[model samples]
Target chain A: MINSISKVINDVGLHARPAAEFVKLASGFQASIKVRNLTSASAWVDAKSIISILMLGVSKDHEVELMADGLDEELAITTLRNLIESNFK
Target chain B: MHYTLVDLLKSEHIMMAVQAADAKAAIELLTAALVESGYAEPEFSVDVWKRELAFPTGLPTQPVAIAIPHADPDHVNNSAVCIGVLATPVEFGQMGTDGSIKLLVNIVFLLAIKEREKQVAMIQQLITLIQSPALLAGLISAKDKNQVLDLIQQTLNEEHK
Candidate 1:
């Protein structure tokens, strides 16, 4: 199990399109992935669910925690972190 | 006074059936309605269409599919969410995919947000309502604009309480 915290830099945060894109990528991995918005005080939610991601109420500069525990934990965390860093571009 | 989303929806006279050939038409039709109601400028529709081409708002929700077609704040005169229930679902590219993939969208939640910063918060509330199967059922089963508005108002207000 591994987890990391990072801020959402996208203009819209992890809402609609960006959240959907992140969920799509996270679902491709075999790891059990979850995300929590530290800024919003939201609980961890299934990373593969776009709607759940939106529930985090993440806005730009909102810090989020991503956790993964499975065979692809490392890969999942890396890719997910990079995706956020790239602003979902 | 802070206007709630429901208030904006009602004041703008948004929420209606849309008969369009595709997503582009649906967006145009909704934005045109807003313009006719004196909510948005005429150019807002065109800008929204372009933004749809760039970053699709199609959300592949369960039980029912929906989309949110919107543009930059510069194009809007007032912040309103114009609901357009497409008679026939149209194809819209998935967001953040740069148009590589598409989804069939039947409900268009065209957002006329005057402030870009507020868009995320509004979407969060909307997604919360949409995440519930029962609420989604309520939204999908609504018959007309008033019914849709009622369902939304009831649901959103319930969430607050």
Candidate 2:
């Protein structure tokens, strides 16, 4: 398993489009990925579920922790971390 | 911050047993409610339909499938919700899937959010409301607009906890 924490830098945080993009990317990987809003101290939710991510209610400058487990965990973690670091570009 | 789900839900915006041909028609039918009520601009229908074509909002919730459609905040004048309980199910592309994946949606919640930042919180509350099968059942079985309003109000009241 691999885990990392990153801050959301985008203007809208992980609200709609950004959250959709994140989930779309996460769904492509075979590993099971989970994310939690560290700033809000929220419970972990499936990273690939758009509804669950939106329910986190993450706002700008909020920190989120992500965990991935399975065969491709390392790649999944790195790719997702980069997506956040790049502000979901 | 002051607005809750109940605040956005108006009795006039709730429609039971709506008849529409497809997803596009369903969205347009509901978007009209928001525009007529001064919550959104006329362009909102076009924008929301485009967004629905892109991301799709259909959720495969048991007993009753639903779609929560929304557009960019720019087209909205007030943050509000428009509910459409379909008289017959319409096919909608399932959310988090390629456009090929579809679900027969029985209800639609057309959201018009005035601020981008508030989308997450409002959707969070919405998900909370939808996740409960009992509440969703109540919403679908609700006979009148006031009954629908009462159900949503009751659920949202428990949501703050």
Best by TM-score: 2
> Scoring model 2 with DockQ, what do you get?
0.16
- Per residue, candidate 1 scores C-alpha lDDT tens digits across A5-85 of 998999988876787678779978998888888997866666765545665678999999999999999999999999999
After superposition, candidate 2 runs with Cα above 4 Å error: A1-89
lDDT of 1 at B66: 79
List runs of model 1 lying over 4 Å from the truth: A1-89, B117-121
Candidate 2 per-residue lDDT over residues A1-89, each given as its tens digit: 88999999988888767887887788789997889999988767668655668867889999999999999999998998898889878
> Candidate 1, residues B52-137: lDDT per residue as tens digits?
77556777787777787777566678778778777778898875355667898877778776744344456667767766667666
TM-score of chain B of each: 0.88, 0.93
Docking class of 1: incorrect
Worst 10 residues of 2 chain A by lDDT: A43-52
In terms of DockQ, the best-performing candidate is 2
